[model samples]
Target: MKLLIMSDSHGWADEVVQVVDRHKHEVDELIHCGDSELQVDSKELSGVKTVKGNCDFGADFPEEIKETYGSLTLYVTHGHHYNVKMTYVPLSYRAEEVGANLVCFGHSHVADCFMEQGVLFINPGSMRLPRKPKEQTYVICDITDTEVEVSFYERVSGEKLTDLSRTYSR
Candidate 1:
């Protein structure tokens, strides 16, 4: 399966729509780590699996989500209660509690894709405002039977060559 991962959109539907439309065929599922700021019941966002960010108000959203996909356990959250803008400790602890094989979060607007203690941690950055100088970015995740290949892409230029691998096999 192919999944498009994004976060911290902050109500920029035009940019988000453009990115999804451009990569629509290439993605099987879309996941947002939070800060969409759209109407909670908006069907326009139905394609994206979203969490609630600190800025996300008046909506019903779970603080955390865990599910099984392929051969991996995925844990998704927005990281406000976890204090993601400050550190990764809270999230790391949550992973341990959930025994997650893959962890997805957003809050700091910094692109992060890496592995630690046999778990994949992904923060897809903010599509509205990227924290770094490169560009606003997201990730394309290809999951197979026992492996996951995550490729990062810059939204402005639409490049998918950057590989951010947090794991290879179970």
Candidate 2:
């Protein structure tokens, strides 16, 4: 399965749409980790699954989502409730409770991907307000039964961050 994940666009609707349109054909699912700042019904989120961020107002969005794609169970969230900026332990525990093979979240606006205790955790960062390494990134995860290849990309330019891409044994 191939999954495209993005987050914290914070209202860069056009860029979000462009990124999705560009990669929709190659991915099996599209996910938005939130702070999109667009209405839940907005066209920008038409075919994407999203969770609510700290900045998101109203109750239209869910705090988290558990979804299955083939053999992979994904735990998706916006990360603020779990205090992601300080640590990922809470989120990891939640993923364990949900029996997830992967966890996707965004709130710190810093792109990152790593494996811990057999679970893969990914944060696509903020396309609009990226921090730290500041690459304005998103992630395309290609999964198989034995391994996962994570490819990070620049949302605006659609260029892959080759150096940041990695493959993990499952």
Candidate 3:
């Protein structure tokens, strides 16, 4: 399965739509890790699974979601409640409790991906207000029985950032 993951758009609805349209056909699932700052019923978010961030006031988006695709289980959240800016401990515990194999979240606007204790954690960064690396980015994950490959891309240009790509053994 392939998944497109993005986060921290913070109201760049058009950019979000453009990115989704560009990759919709290649990914099996679309995910937004929150801070979108769009209403729950916004057309831009129509087919995407999203969570609520601290900035998404009264949007009625869920704080987290768990989904199973094929043999993989994903735990998605905005990460504010888990204090992800400080540490991954809380988020890791929650993912474990939910029996998730992959965890997706965003709060610090820093793109990152890594494996810890058998679970893969991904943060796609902020597409509108990036922090570290100074790149507006998102991620696409390709999953198979033996490995998971993650590739980050420039949000506006849709160009893959090969330097940020990673492949983890599953």
Estimate the Cα RMSD of every predicted model relative to the unseen true structure.
2.0, 1.0, 0.7
Task: Please report how far candidate 3 places residue 45 from its true position, in Å.
Answer: 0.2
Model 3 TM-score is 0.98
Clashing pairs in 3: none
Q: Give the poorly placed runs of model 3, Cα more than 4 Å off.
A: none
lDDT of 1 by residue, 93-156 (tens): 9999998988899898988777788888888888888885357888887778777787778888
Q: Which digits, one per residue and each the tens of the lDDT, describe model 2 over residues 1-170?
A: 99999999887889999989999999999999989988899998998999998888873888899988778999999999999999999999999999998999999998889999999999987888999457799999999989999999987789999888899998
- lDDT, candidate 2, equals 0.91
Kindly provide the TM-score of model 2 when superposed on the true structure, using C-alpha atoms: 0.97
Best TM-score among the predictions, by candidate number: 3
**Consecutive 10-residue window with the lowest summed lDDT within model 1:** 161-170
Clashes of each: 0, 0, 0
Off by over 4 Å in 2: none
